[model samples]
Target chain A: MSATTLTIQRVSPDAIARVIDDAPLEPFGLTDAHRRALAARLGAITTDHHRRLDSWLVERGGRVAARFAWSPLAARRLLGSGGFRRALRGRAASIRDGVRDEIEDLLARAASGRAHRGSLGDWLAHRHPAELALVQASAVEWARILAETGATVTGDWTVASADAYYDVERARTTLRARRDLLVLDGEVVVRVRAGGPTPSAGPGLRADLAAAAFAHPDGRAPRRYVGIWPDAGVILAVDGTLANVRAGTRDLVRATIALHRQGELRAA
Target chain B: MTPTTTPARSILEDLRGDRSERPPRDIETAAGLRATLDAELLAIRSVPARTSPLVISASDVTHHGDAVDITHATSGRLRGALIGQLIRLVAVGHEIIDPFDDALRAWRLDSPSPTLIAAYADLDANGRARLATDVAAHAASLRRALADVPSAWAVRTAVRARVPLAGGVVVLHDVVDLVVGSYCDASSSTVLLDVTTSPIGRSATSLLGFHAFVHCLRTSVVPLRVAIFSTATGELISRDVDETWLELAANDVLDVARRA
Candidate 1:
């Protein structure tokens, strides 16, 4: 007899207040204390693992592997514009090992699967010294930015943390998607990309935000999707919509079919 | 399915929302193409396995040119690695090692080509600088391509699919740069993707053609569409595949054999 009209509301950063509680800000309910434990466990990557990876990479690729622990910027500076051997003159048998042990240790955890957040940020490793350095720097910078932006649980976060609150399509569904950070009481979903100069968010990033928001079993959609290029010091905030999620899911489904249709075909 | 049930339409036009339709070619029957491929593979197996005895990738078939453009090849290598990393980042989230770095490291461990390995090991400063710049540019393009991908989708990098042509004697292998979506045993369910730094001549078409038939042989399920993203041009071109198109590609492969 009657059709109720629905009006959409605009989401603003100001609408959400920053939670800066040291008691551990649990957006999706992964207890702050639990997150600290996970972080501590992951951060405690053994020194032996670092030595192994470093040595292994170097042995496989020669000096580039170990020599590349430097950032691209630093590498260019150290590798002055000269003859190849001249550029690398005395670059061998590094009398001084300057590459941070922390970054390497973190990498060891990631490679071992001990550091997988499942639905949070990643501790990605790179082969290029510059790329490796860039990632390490970005992590530090991102930490600083999040601290400045009114969140305390930046180190170990995801949409599915125990402290987090969200709806999923099913109770038994395992979350394969990862969200960078959750704020505004988990109303805002943030995905971070750091390594080089901060770049703009594109279709892929948008699709990711949409999928993460819709898959939320909490039956509630995130108010906003924020893309942060902490390295570039850029923040792109967009209204999260169901359409993007559906589109993303559509692409995802298409990709899956293409990649694994053969196996499924065999099974069928 | 007959043309009555699934009439051929302009797949590229549908995706790009443009009217650049190419005339459809006479297509060979799937059974006939399969027979031809079987016979060729059988003949090859009659002789001792002189060359590599494993899977035959689309690259081997399409990139049969005699002239090896080092720059072109180098570009492809860098682009492939960068794109692979991007896909892994999207699918697995920075879980993989830097493929480029690892590749260089792998080269040292297994020197497939002594000359190539020596060249790399003894790369002059100028050459190395140029390579670094080129690699960075390609890597950036890959990152850009990946950033646009959604996290909810299932993404895989350097995905390998294989099917033996002649009783496992000659295996036709295909390595896709990236694949998005899930494997539903339906015609229009998946999207097969390829990424290239510098557009290789007729590579997109060849890969798409191989993908259509190889997928059918492997899974009996055809992908919904095939796409190629040229990192150099920033173009994502795509086309939907049907039985007719698959037949045409199979015939073209036969033609290559005939000409040879």
Candidate 2:
């Protein structure tokens, strides 16, 4: 079991571009135009999320919704497909006013179904209830997604709690062996550490949690790393802001650790 | 008689090469010129940010023959240095309302002989004297108009006399987007015309249409010269510019600015 955790970094447009370029879509005969359009669409959605999330944080005064709004995949599904064309085909004509109205109607319809579920308050409750500031339904969802990929995970993990008032701060404290709970299936495992931080009315709690996770221990460690695969070779590591962390950060940590291990082995 | 050599033909060429060797008299004078140049650059750069919201008709004549009327938007710091140089050249010594009537107009006009040059020379050095004083006043007016604002105003003055050319007409428009300065500022003038037409032939015959327009501005209307820097790229990318459309748009913008 590795002591350290995985760290998350802010995402950049260039990094996202590289990710898109490396993805499997390259083997197929997708045109540069198509690739560009997809990348642009993803970038736009990410930008919207960042902006809305920051504003939501400011307006709500540190109360974050659990689900982190819509998933990137869901955004792509809803907006990137031929849905716009299908919705507007028969209704709009050459008449400017008619076309505008039809377009508006189509957008309204599309926005109707998922609007309520995507609220910040509800998402936060789902992700982290009053019981624990760190664990949330979104984090669970991420763990499940990782598990389904057949990664090795150490389940029923736990950690030590302290006077820390935020998830980020509590993440820095070392977890006691007995109080922690670890759950593992396939590649992903969840470790719930007891007694650290509780949600407080004070400001900057989330940011603290985020910093401690990346810089401290107790979160995004070996379990999070090897949990990405069933075979469990390279250890992933990090601390804090598990869900809504920059996508693919776990893999980055795994790659970094793996390179370090290789160098060690060669030296030995 | 002052010993005179053929003055540089085009101020645009000198500026383009970073050879503005004719330095201002003092530090304050040079600083004034620099400040005005900077303001114009800012004005040009602001176009992209402002126009980013507005849906405009864009065309790339270099690649496509027709215009692509789409509701595309963009925001960035656009490059206007090249275009600004050309503009400053056109603005050097023209009168506030009648830039083309000044002795500086000789820079672009043909002077075949010494006799011809003397005939049109500044008889009393009035042209040289008027240039500095008039330009200073104009600069002051421009400064006042552009202060405390992200946008400026402009006016479209007609060009008088027929230019022997073809295809499209070259219109001379004013370049005042500031309101607080003198009534007329000597700025670069836009010679709007379709570049596809040859300098000779029937297409060039309408070159003189703007000459009368310039005359109108000198007398009744204030002739203004403005700088317009534009670059179009993407699926409809092109190095070629359609001066006719730009001229029309400039005219429209000028009217709007003056009225406001």
Model 1 residue A151 lDDT score: 31
Q: Candidate 2 residues B161-232, lDDT tens each? A: 211000111112322211111111222222221111011222111222222122222221122222111112
User: CAPRI verdict on model 2?
Assistant: incorrect
Name the TM-score of candidate 2: 0.16
Report, to 2 decimal places, the DockQ of model 1: 0.01
Every candidate's chain B TM-score: 0.67, 0.18
Question: Which sections of candidate 2 miss by over 4 Å?
Answer: A1-78, A81-268, B1-241
In candidate 2 the C-alpha lDDT for residue A179 amounts to 11
Q: What is the DockQ of candidate 2?
A: 0.01
Residue-pair clash count for candidate 1: 44
Please state the CAPRI-style docking class of candidate 1.
Answer: incorrect
- lDDT, residue B82, candidate 2: 16
Please give each candidate's TM-score: 0.41, 0.16
